[model samples]
Target chain A: MKGKLYGIGVGPGDPGLMTIRAKELLDGAQVIAYPVKKPGEDGTALEIIKQKVDISGKEVVELLFSMNPDDEVRKRCRAENIDRICGMLDQGKDIAMITLGDVAVYSTYMYLDREVRDRGYETEVVPGIPSFCHGAAKAGLPLMIGEESLAVLSMAKHDIGKVEKAVDCIDNIVIMKAFASIREIADMMGRKGIPLSNATVMSNIGMEDEYVGPLETDRKYGYFTTVLIKKKVN
Target chain B: MKGKLYGIGVGPGDPGLMTIRAKELLDGAQVIAYPVKKPGEDGTALEIIKQKVDISGKEVVELLFSMNPDDEVRKRCRAENIDRICGMLDQGKDIAMITLGDVAVYSTYMYLDREVRDRGYETEVVPGIPSFCHGAAKAGLPLMIGEESLAVLSMAKHDIGKVEKAVDCIDNIVIMKAFASIREIADMMGRKGIPLSNATVMSNIGMEDEYVGPLETDRKYGYFTTVLIKKKVN
Candidate 1:
């Protein structure tokens, strides 16, 4: 029997947030794979699952998925990772590639899952709680209550105009990867008459060092940071 | 000691998709409350949990949360529901209010949760897998690739212009409540040069009768239907 590839979302920094199916897959899988920016770096997905499941007997593979912007570089990295994953599947080893959040939402596993499936391998994606949802819950913010629309944007590639439009129109906006352009986004929201109080910046949610507060444009934030903006009630 | 209110997200139709925390809370809670359009109606949240956890001895209360547009009627309904929940909490009965999909995103429980919290009761929100994430996974579609932005809109209350703008600009769009305006939204996407092939309509995901296919505007869909559109590659 051929082995299957499971893309399991570990959820945002919480072991309890992981679905029962994810935990079951993690405990039973012979080979566990998680993405890392570098070979020696610790992966968040691995860290989250480690808290709940024992990985002492499983073969843990760190798939290198760099944060490089160069397409050629990223393509090469994905190719190598896919090759390694396929090699394991060929050995009839069921591999579970754990991801930080939901696999379908801006996850590196999506690319790897697509490549594996295109090569005629069985693949399954188990949805986990997305980070934005966690951020909203932690911040005690209601994301789109009663007829409200929500726009989730990654600031890494979007232009300022798009960000402004989202803030102006959408009832709730979640800006991911807000590390670099958080100041700029805050300024834009200010220009658009969006109150600073309406925006909450949360970093490392569900972690010991989690930070949740009003958006501060001047402060530097880590990559795991997210800004949730709820339109002010008139 | 006053009992706490746990707002649990049951996820989309699948018993396996429920988080371990949600299941634990469901099993331990003295009272289980779920929203319904009317009393005696079986709610989707209740149905999903019924498949996994036994509710034989637990007090099951179906809170009426009608979809009526009249503000006065909705307000009164919410007030009554809050009163009942507070009464349970006052009696030191831990109440677990189950919602379909994530409670933090577009959930009726948000209002009830806020009301409970404001009335000096402890409330905790456990995130569950949102329906759109499940829909994307079931359809084998990536919601946001790389730095793509995602917009989640409810067509039940949004105007055509807002929907058109979202389709035109957002990299990924998930349209909920597309039952009434699925045809119009399809036409708008077509006019915006977005290929119909890029859109997938999924209904009752993870359920036995789940439907996944290319967006067919001609077909009538139940309210559980969702339209996921990934922007056409240039």
Candidate 2:
């Protein structure tokens, strides 16, 4: 029998935010698979799990995933990772793949999950709290309410336009990977007279050196950053 | 010396999906407050907490908030609830106001939190897994990836136009309170040549009689229903 795959979302960098199912799956997994940019260092997802469940005795495998700007390079890395994951499934190892935030969101586990399923291996995607939600909670603000609409987009040049379009329709907006386009977003919102207090930038949420404050373009922020824009607050 | 407010999210109706922090606050809460419609019945949020925590001897308060279409009635009811809550806090009773999902996202707790904060009481919001994320995970589908964007809107006649606007831009959309506008949204999606497979509706997520399936306009769904629309699928 081929082993099953559990794509568990460990929550947005918060160990305390991890679900009961996430902890149970990680604790009972025969093998642990986590994405790591650097070979020896644990990724954010693994770091979160470690804070709750011990993985010392488990077969922990660190897989490298490319975050290169080039599309081809990223695709190649993903294909190679899929191949490696399938090979493990054939060995009857119940592998648990951990990712930061919900796998249903932008987590790379979504792609891997489909790949594993296509190869006739069983897979389960366990949902967890996303960063934007946690960011809202931490910032003491509501994302949306009472007929309000929201748009959640990746921060890119194209998204700047989306923000403009979204502003006309959406009452709230959350931009992930916001560091690269932080300046433009802050300026655009500033131009619209949407006070800096209405827009919040949270970096490394629930992690060390976490930041939650008014939108600022002056300083550099970490990779895991999210910007939230609200039209109304009480 | 007023009581603090903890707006706890219990997670999309699933007991196992509740976060460690939600459990801790509830276990330590001096008074538990939950929204209820009928006088003698516990709402969905309270029922979920009952599954994990023993509220037998704890101080549990049931709040009534009008869901009537009349805006004035709803506002009147909210004012009353806030007044009642403030009275509790004045007594230095630490209240744990639990909601169905993340308090920051369309939960009634948002209004109460703001009101309580305005009255000078500290309120902490603990995020939880939302129904849409859990619905996507339950359906074995990804909400969005790469540069794909997502729009989350409440189902309404006005939102039908938002969907039309969103279809041209967003790669994914999630509609909450979908039961009311189910048919119209389905027909619109159908008219736009979006296959039913691209949209998945999950009702009573994580609760008993949970459902996950293609968008069906002819059927009736519960209050907790969420509809997820994906532009593409693998």
Candidate 3:
């Protein structure tokens, strides 16, 4: 019998936030896969599941991933990784690839899911709590309430123009991975007269360096940072 | 110490999709509250928890919530419910209010959370797997990937105009509670010359009569319908 590939979301760095299905699948899986910037580097997805399930005896597969802007490099690396993962599946090993948030949302596993499925392997995507929900919950803010509209955008450097247009129409906005462009976002909010008080900046949520507060344009923030902006003007 | 309030999300109808934190809190809570349209009505939130945790001997608080369009009625009913909840807290009885999906997104708990805090009560919101995530996972589609922007709008009757503007700017969009405006949305999609192939319509996800398919304008969807539209035009 062929093994099925599973993409599980561990949720925003909290083992408690992980769905029961995710933990259960990870416990039973023969091979565990997660992305890392380089070989030997620990990933957050692993740390999260480690807190709840004792995976000391399980086989760990560290898939090298790149956040580099070059399309060629990313495609080549992803292709190589999928080939390696497919080899394990060929051996009838149930491989479970874990991600930070919902695998359907901005996850590297999302790209690999289609590729693995095309190779004639069964695939399942297990949904998890997205980081933005944790940011909203920690900030005690409603992501949206009573017909309010929400726009979630990945903020790149100089991506202020798209944000401006979204701000014009969307009632509330959550900008994920704001580490690279947090200063630019703060500047745009300043120029547009959007209050910093309206923003909830979360960095490394549920981690040791976790910070949930107003935007600090002058200071640098760790990855896993998200800035949630609520339009109080309206 | 005053009794604390908890808002737990049971997740889009699948008991296994519920976060470990949500299930753990519910298991220990003495008073379990869930919203219903009328007294003695069975809510999906209660049904979801029943599959996982045994709450048969625990106290059940049925919060009467109306989907009425009238603002005055909603406000009056909400005020009464909050007052009753505050009284329970006054007696030092902990209340766990359960909601569908994340409590921070379009849940009645969002409104009550603020009121409960203002009355000197502690409130905790445990985020859950949103229905949209499950919809995307079920359809085998990414909600947003690689700098893509997502707009999540609650669609009301005659709300096609807002969606049109969002379609112009957002890369992908998820319209929650699309039952009332499904046909109008179908008409708008056709009028704008956008292909229906890019849309995934999910109705009553993970429940009996659950339907996931392309837009069928002729059929009437249930109240839990959500339409996920991808802007392939961009």
Candidate 4:
């Protein structure tokens, strides 16, 4: 018996943002898996789906994968954990690993996808609404016009210089995973004449905690933060 | 009673890609509006949702809009149609206009969003799955790494040179709406020493018609297309 793996993106924390495909996968899958930073911590992806759909029906699997930064530790844990996941698949369990935003962009699920592929298991990825798209939509701004260049950057390394170069080059820039480095981004945008007022910062988009407005200097950044800088179309 | 207009995105002809919020808007709104090139033509947005959702409970509104390059004709038609949509809102109809992909990414809904704002009618936008994200996911490629830049472009404009410049400078490029000038892009990408075999082109992502593979020169481009050129990671 062979089992299939699904990388399903549930979109940013708004349940309504879950694509019809994601919902179907959730309802039909034999096992619904989600990553948790530690036990009992709220999952950004699971929270998004739980809001609208009753996920209690599926055989839920919680994969405790800490986001701590030890490369070797993560690799080892992921390998061992994936082997366990594969063991269940060996029992003909159709599994789904739900994620936030699009699974291709900055998703940890890629590691598992690679594992499944290397093990000769079939896998498919279901796309979801990206947080940046939601931020741009809420801002009432055009992310790409006739020929505008768009870019998405992660500020995890906290490299202000590299981020500045990106902002300098792209016509429209979407910075994601940028909580720790929001101040540097804001300052660079201001100095580059990008106009802080023109930029929009959306935190927890599409959820009750959703906040969207002119870039605020005082707002503390979080892992879920996204900033979209587009030249104000006059 | 003045009703509000919602510009919602129905992602890339896949019912599963439609966000949970987008589904709610599509179902609960008094009118579900969508754009079409000609009267009675199958609307992309409506067709996506009609598969999984029974929208028979909602009144359908078709907004006939053309994307012809003729400036005067397009501008005039857009203004008139927007006026008509606004009138529906004024008549106490809560209308949800569905656009393919995210409403803010090179989407016609952005124009409507601006027009509605300019007219002082309160409007909100619900974002959907972006085709570029979907393309990357379907192709099994990561869009960007930490501090890495990703550029998205369209090939219709003569400004392909400018796009090339950005692509040259950026780490990854996702070109959308490139069905018409794929050869030119392929040529430029090849000149840049970016392996065409490594470059993934996805069309109709998330839909049954979705196709993803390495760039093949013999293949003809489709209307809904995305080309991703990713830097080889060490």
Candidate 1 chain A TM is: 0.94
Per residue, candidate 3 scores C-alpha lDDT tens digits across A96-185 of 999988887888888888889988999999999999999888877889887689999987655889998898888898998788888788
Writing each residue's lDDT as its tens digit, candidate 2 over B1-234 gives 998999999988779899988988898898999987667675788888888888877888989888888989988999999998899889999899998878877888888888789888898999988888888899888888878888998875446887777776777989888878888888888889988878889887766668899877788887778888888865
lDDT values, one for every candidate: 0.85, 0.85, 0.88, 0.78
The model with the greatest lDDT is 3
**Which whole-number lDDT from 0 to 100 does residue B87 have in model 1?**
90
Off by over 4 Å in 3: A216-220
Predicted structure 1, TM vs. truth: 0.96
Local lDDT at A66 for model 2: 81
lDDT of 4 at B172: 81
lDDT of 3: 0.88
Stretches of candidate 2 off by over 4 Å are: A69-72, A156-158, A190-193, B69-72, B156-158
Worst 10 residues of 4 chain A by lDDT: A204-213
In terms of docking quality, model 3 is high
lDDT of 2 by residue, A1-234 (tens): 899999998888878899988998898998999987656775768777888898988998888888788989988998998898888889998999998899878878888887789888999989999988999999888888877888898875446887777766677889898888888887788777787678899898765768999877787888788999887765
By descending DockQ, how would the candidates be arranged?
Answer: 3, 2, 1, 4
Candidate 4 local lDDT, A68-183, one digit each (tens): 68888877878877998899889999998998888877777877887788898888888887778877877788787765777777777776776676666678788777777777
Error at B216, model 4, angstroms: 1.4
Clashes of 4: 9
Full candidate order by TM-score, most accurate first: 1, 3, 2, 4
Chain B TM-score per candidate, please.
Answer: 0.94, 0.91, 0.93, 0.92
